[model samples]
Target: MQREGSPWRGLGVVTQKELSDHLSSARMLVIQLLVVVTGVVIVLVSLQQIRDITAEDPFLLLRVFTRSGEQLSFVFVMTLLVPLLAIGLGFDLVNSEHNQRTLSRILSQPIYRDALLFGKFLAGLATIAISLTAMWMVVIGLALSALGVPPNGEELARAALMLVVTIAYAGVWLALAMLFSVLFRSPATAALCALGLWLFVSILWPLLSGHLVNVLFPPSATTADALLNSLSMHQAFRRLSPGALFAEIVTVLLDPAMRSTQQSQLAAMGLALVEPGSIPGAPLPLLESVLIIWPQMVGLIGGSIVLFVIGYVVFQRQEVRA
Candidate 1:
């Protein structure tokens, strides 16, 4: 007979121990320092351009998170660097235990593999959470203190949403790193694989997306067919890369005047929508903003869960010693 609480037994202990190790580790410190440094640089470098542009802005505080007109934005920095941090934390998560001759020993205890995997993943996520939270505070604090403008209620709510979106995005990378850690026995192999995925997705995927889109939607089609094909290709291509999905979400959240799509709505309202891009207008309500990017948020969160589940299944089926 199975014990009633045995499945979840020691879950908390394992999570706490792993989380503590991550928090106190030198690696975490270095990653966090990198985040802090990058955040400060973006804020300082873009501060002037953002100031010049948003001089009359009501939501200037939120601009810190989104403004990258003259330089890379804060969120952009995260998109580039956070994945590396995640990979660093997770590339060795499972394989290191095996290398240390501890996996079999740990499983020989009462703890379920379920608990062990969940605990370790949670710990890595917690470390990422800590890093993100600190960076959020530092970036906003510097912006507010420098600009001398406190965040309005709407700004606060939107910033919170942005943070949630960011965490989900980071989780996808963390899960991928863990998946690699599980699939590859060598820690270096896992790290290199994860890093390779990051580079290809972040750097090469978009270029390929463009070429593929052009090849699939040639100029010979009718105008209406071309437009439809273009729109469909754009959406499909955007969904292919988590980077594009995240960028779109952040753009809508941070820049209130930014009205990228919704041409029909503008046309219905008898507004002259700009041809190049939607003209700047009053910022959308928080509810409206979230509704606009809800699909992207779901894609990011869903992708993370799917990756995590794959890792979980692989971990469960593997020979305990491996």
Candidate 2:
């Protein structure tokens, strides 16, 4: 009874169904409205700041936009927003189906379990992309109107890269949410667990790292400089968190110039330059900064993919009752 055509036929059909369902959902409308409103607020604030600065300068708008962009990039917003949105969207993905007694009927169709999961994941990702894209457009338009010129080619390229990084960052949370949805019988439990994980990674983990380092090496005058010269517990803790990784990546991409600042500090610290002249005065290249962040991006994205795959496998094998 199996069709002899493409092996992905079932997957395609499920994806279509998922997309259709998402498009018709009221949730999408509400999310879009919120994103638009937030974007407008950011632009208005930036414009007001520009007005408060030296008004006669032609480059005033550019300076203001650059400063604003540095402060409110896509990555920064995604770091804060992705977990909440992903958890809300996915915390009940499976549990609700079972609660409504629809899981049995869905499984009775020709679609494979893998297809169902894949479809749902793609649909959620699509929703995130749409919301982010709309926000980015609004920001860009506001920048253009306020600045009186379009963004340069390099700036545009960076903005596009920022968007991609944001989506990938959101993927990590979405996968985690899906995993919890499959693992927990109650949607509320899944959402709470997701929030707990977010708090641990974003806030508690860094605080614990700082406390542990202080305890391990109580600061002496000499040891103070040495401890400061050593790895930054803050940076190390940040590297441990996906949100921090996302922020660093966005910063590096948007302002490639900051690479020099990072390199200078690293050189000064790596060489134990307590006197500040132990290392040469050469600045770091933009390429080097990009190279440093590339591994971090790979790690975060890979971790997200691995988690998603694990969740998918677990969900596929799960026994659902009507």
Full-model lDDT for every candidate: 0.81, 0.71
Residue-wise C-alpha lDDT for candidate 1, range 27-91, written one tens digit per residue: 98898889899778777876876777857788888877766553576656777887888888999
The C-alpha local distance difference test score for the whole of candidate 1 amounts to 0.81
Runs in model 1 deviating more than 4 A are 1-6, 221-225, 260-280
Candidate 2 lDDT tens digits, 71-94: 674445567777766676677777
Task: Please report the candidate that would top lDDT against the real structure.
Answer: 1
Colliding residue pairs in candidate 1: none
